[model samples]
Target: MDKIVQFVQKSEHNATAVAIFGAIGVAVVALKALSFLKVLVDVFLRSGINLKKYGAGRGGWA
Candidate 1:
């Protein structure tokens, strides 16, 4: 496709910009993956969570 060709032939500045944006995108995706794994592990592993023992989250509404 024409767009692919243009992307392949991008100027140095554009290429650098693309690389930086791509790195940022990768980091965001990795963070999301890590968060999902954390939630999955908590769902399967965290047991007998006594919020009652912790008490009503500093109750007494303002």
Candidate 2:
């Protein structure tokens, strides 16, 4: 645990390491967002109906 903390502190003191870490963090977040979008697309495709058309239909609890 101490070694991990020391490594983090050392990295924080370096500008290049900080920039690399920031870029890696951004990439991870972007990948997760893209995965969520893919799942949503798959769900939409399986439902076989357009969201706009479904929303316009009369149904309970509108």
Candidate 3:
């Protein structure tokens, strides 16, 4: 933690770059987490459309 503070205080440009990249990294991780949660919800809490109703694999005029 102290090292990080020292590094940031070393230069304004370095601090800015670090802040930008950190925010981007945080956003990417958050998006990935949300996507994973959505997948879990889809798999366990929601049902997909029934393909049988559309005649998918019923040998109906492929």
lDDT of 3 by residue, 26-62 (tens): 9999999999999999999998898888898979775
RMSD of each: 5.3, 9.6, 2.9
Residue-level lDDT tens digits of model 1 in 1-62: 88965985777777788789989999999999999999998999888576765565768343
Query: Each candidate's TM vs. the true structure?
Result: 0.67, 0.52, 0.72
Q: What is the Å distance of residue 26 in model 2 from its true position?
A: 0.4
Task: Write candidate 2's Cα lDDT for 1-62 as tens digits.
Answer: 87756676785566567678899999999999999999998988666656556565556245
Q: State the displacement of the C-alpha of residue 49, model 3, in Å, after optimal TM-score superposition.
A: 2.8
Q: Cα miss at 38, model 1 (Å)? A: 0.2
Q: What shift in Å separates residue 60 of candidate 1 from its native position after superposition?
A: 20
Identify the leading candidate in terms of TM-score: 3
- Clashing residue pairs in candidate 1, if any? none
1 or 2: which has the higher TM-score?
1
Error of 1 at 23 (Å): 0.5
Model 2 TM-score relative to the real fold = 0.52
Give residue 34's error in model 1 in angstroms. 0.3
Model 3, 34: alpha-carbon shift in Å? 0.8
